[model samples]
Target chain A: MSRRFASLGLALALVCGLAPARESAAADTYAVDAVHSAVVFRIKHMNTSHSWGRFNELTGTFALDEASPSQSHFEFQVKTGSVDTGNAKRDQHIKGPDFFNATQFPTISFKSTSVAKGADGYDVTGELTLHGVTKPITVKIVPVGVGKGPTGGSIAGIDTSFTLKRSDFGMNKMVGPVGDDVWVNVSIEGGKK
Target chain B: MSPAGMMLATLVLPFVSAGLVMIGAGWLGRRLGIERADHAAAALAVGVGYVVGHAAIASPTFPPLDVTDRIPWLAGLAAILGILESIWPGPSWTLWENRLLLTALVLSALLGPLFAESSENRPSTVCLVVYGLIALASWTNLSGLADRLSGARLGVPLLTVGFGIAIALVVSGSLALGQLSAVLAAAVAAMVLLKLGSPMLLGTVPVMVATFGALLLNSFIYAALPASAAVALVSAPAAFWVSRLGRMERLATWKVVLVTEFATLIPVGIALALAFSASPGYAE
Candidate 1:
């Protein structure tokens, strides 16, 4: 009877250990590919047309827990001075104190707090810090594809979009000419780290 | 509210609130036997009014405990100090104590904009030092001018005009900054009215605090105008000495007032013109 109990305890311990290994196998870490990833934003201009811009620099990492999506995490930072609206003069003005105040607040960042699997993909709730203010925001993320890369590494594609008010981040300048509601779209190709 | 309505409210609320507070404080002072209550009241009014005005126009996400929010509280503290000085009138504040107070005020103002950002993006040490020097010099010169012109009834009005032009210039560049500038202008206007009733409050600590605080706001937070233009505006009051030219002191009070306003306007007008020419095409 003693021998049977000891064997049972060992088997239970092995099962528990194997379960985490299996879960972690599905949890892959990825480094954002700056060359393929893009963050773009658009806002209404003068109530007639939309003005579009993009950030040239971005750096972040993500952990995708496929089995348990609740354990997934993501964080990203974008250089505010890298804002490019296709107009050099306009870009400089935007970087000035009137808008981003890049010298004072150089980076706009987001860090996920909780992620949950949704019907289509996932809903990620996080704190976005922009223009020196931090606010809770939720992003709807859709998985684009997962495939093997040319470098023999696994790559995952994701698309995310969210809408935020510029004034909420204290970027209230030129609200009449430049719309307050800004829509952001991000397309990322992350490779296994 | 419409965007236009929001902007209007942002500008008007602070002006009205500061004016009311100043007037109310004056009435209360007379009843309470406090001779310098007008100055303290003006400072407190401006501080409170600014917070309210900012909140009215600010986004719902604005943090309640931000470093920028401390401006009003600091101004309030300065007002309290002014009241204490009025009540005690005992031993004079030591030179070190005075210097320390001035340093603290200037540093606090500078930190407002810097601390608004996350730690990784904070300004460099070199930038901070440069800002500190400029702020210190501007505050010292302006306060000195205020001391010299304290006895002159026109002094406060001249300062008010300076602030008004700053608002117009800032508004032309950034609406949010313009709102802040408008609040400062209103606060100064209220203080001017208080000074008219109680001339003794004109050059008190509270008045200096309000003046320096407004200048800091223009220079640091709403840096839409060029640095040179801002410096010129702050230093315009230093030109008050020109009004004290030979034989001008003996002139009638009305003539002195006219000369002082005119002299102060010369630099201020030039500064405004520079600001307009340098401003980036009116917030486009």
Candidate 2:
């Protein structure tokens, strides 16, 4: 009877010791601050000139799962109406149904599916939902660093990039000869959750 | 074009088509007249078409060839060369020599349509094709120069131990080999395709043949079996082989170009097929 009790106590101690390690494996989550991140694209103008532009007003949540990336999740909402170029007329035209159709599909989103660590970074695979279509996208992410924020909070910074076919998500209409690819640049800052 | 597409266009199709045309163009070129133009016109037309096509594939405009101006004239000039290669059997160049030159020209032409940035699909696809052609071209030149420098030294082995390691890894099922093997094969082919100064078809044939043979061998290894292996399998050996071949080649101007007319024909055919297939109302 004494040996049984002692064995049970030792098992309990082992379980208690492992709890913190498992907890540490959980990656922190962060809320993306739109003002800090930039979403931009470039297209060839008339097969001669290259033109660039950006979209403003984005709100999103980034969940980092250090333990199991498959368990991680990312949800982002970009206001379709925020499409902007230096030219107001072009911006307006882009927002119309022929382009972004902001009124029709009001949000562009991404959700994480998996993450695999690599030599200097990690490969993050996810589904990017845009223009009412969802497609698998993978991006290579390098952790810039992690530290405390001005608000007495912890934060993590990461940079990632991937390419998507605009036409795949039904963004086929164009004002001119703009090609179908739209490259995405992701700069994310996550806070401990 | 997305990066994925660029991967396909620049890295994949160029080598595939180059291999295919190299194998078949002798009879086809006879029908098409691929060798007739004076060397200068032939070179300029092929070079310009190749460069322009490359520029278009890389840019975002999806630029269509200029229908009204210089493009047609260039096309006509290229067409004349095409006719010469196909029908004219009267030249000093043997069947093997003709085949080699045609393959190189086709690859060069195709490179124009395939070169693109890695992130965009259209460009990536084009880039993959260009990469494949370049790989084949690189190998051809490497071997040609090596042979000339050695005066037909037969002891050099183009396939290194790395090839066996890759084959073993691939067969054992560790990494994805399809796309990677294709790319590695191109690399091997490129190492041999390095040029010598002479324009003589006979001078270029051996290197082109050996480079292309290596690419085919790599492709055959993968196509014959659906295996999982990291790209390093083929790439590691290709790197080793390229170094060995380069070391053997004597000092000479590296101006050798693997770009050619047949290269244009294949991608244009593929692109046209894609465009037609993607036409409105076509099933996804």
Candidate 3:
């Protein structure tokens, strides 16, 4: 009778949105620590060496679970005008109409729609909006590690790198000289709530 | 094309159109016996140069997603409207009315986007509206100068102002805006090459004026251009009135021109100086 009663309660708990004690109940929410995280990009200059740049301002949040990859999600918003390339003149030109067009399209954003476990880590499919154009992009994100934060909160490190065609986003200017392929590298440190 | 290539094209294409198309159309109009076709040709040449020059830098997107993408298409519209205004046999008031409507449309296209977005960095709506009114008034007076003054008298001031504004924008941290401004000046130079000291105005006046207002507004709102510098730049062309001194009977044309050039340089100098001092690009 005791074993039968335990099974009935277990069934009720499952129906009431409770998970088994051994399994994760929900994904942990992590607010991106902008100070420690960074998004950087490099494009070939004249098809020779790479030219590097980074967005100075970024804000985002993510929910992640290794056990339940389906529940994992990431979203990021980057201020387009904050593009810093070290050279002031080229920075202005890049921010102008020919490139990002920062005034009209002030923000570049990404919101993940799906996440799936891959061989290395998780393959996240999301919409990346850039230069006033939005397109679906899939990126491979690896779980670097996890530790305690300065405030004694849980923390996680994720790393990702992807290549995208500039022409695909309607940025076709100087295609030959500036090259079409841009490689983006992101290292994110998120603090768990 | 590379940036250097784009800059070269910006300066050269307009000169080519103005030099070749303007004279060719005027001569052909006389040969084919089409009246006022020369006036229409002037507008067409400048518009063609402007659109082509801008496209050479950045090909516009389909449906124009970005504000700058509309530049080539807007230049096309201004050319068409200018040709109609030039050829219309309607009353003077009707021509002015058509021009007024065109001004409103152009202002909305350029300034409307800036005003729609609520951002602290952007100029206030009232200031932008007043700036548009100032640009409109500036164009009207410059067009009047086109009727009384022609040749270097008209072209030099425009060229100087264009180069000045271009320099100011570049210093204020927008190479693209500076290049765009220089492109307009190049088109005007082309028109002046064809019709020096002729005492007539063409549709190019409205075309240049409309585009100039839009570019200046973008420079201030989008780039690091300061508001005070924009005002001084907008009012820079008004100094063309000083060229009226050439109309004096006893004044040597060279003496009158020298003084006119210096007078036109004042506002541009002030604007450039202000841009250098106040621009966030420089301050940072």
Which candidate number would show the highest lDDT if scored against the true structure? 3
TM-score against truth, every candidate? 0.76, 0.39, 0.88
lDDT of 3 by residue, B68-107 (tens): 6666677778788777777664687876776677777776
**Which residue pairs come into collision in candidate 1?**
none
lDDT by residue (B24-115, candidate 1, tens digit) is 87689778988766655655666666666655654323342333344445555555665555555445454235535755675655455556
Model 2 Cα displacement at B60 (Å)?
22
Between prediction 1 and prediction 2, the one with superior TM-score is 1
Which window of 10 residues has the lowest lDDT sum in candidate 3 chain A? A16-25
> How should the candidates be ordered by TM-score, best one leading?
3, 1, 2
Top candidate (DockQ): 3
**lDDT for each residue of candidate 2 in B1-284, tens digit (9 for 90 to 100):** 44565455434443343333333443454455655222222222222332232222332222322111122233333334444433354464454464455444544333332233421213355644644564455445543544343211211223232233333323322112222333333332322232113232332222333223333222222122212222322222223223234433442322111111122223333333432332222122
Q: What is the C-alpha lDDT of each candidate?
A: 0.67, 0.45, 0.78
- Model 2, B204: alpha-carbon shift in Å? 69
Model 1 / residue A179 / CA error / Å: 5.7
- Model 3 earns a TM-score of 0.88
Q: Residue-pair clashes per candidate, as listed?
A: 0, 80, 2
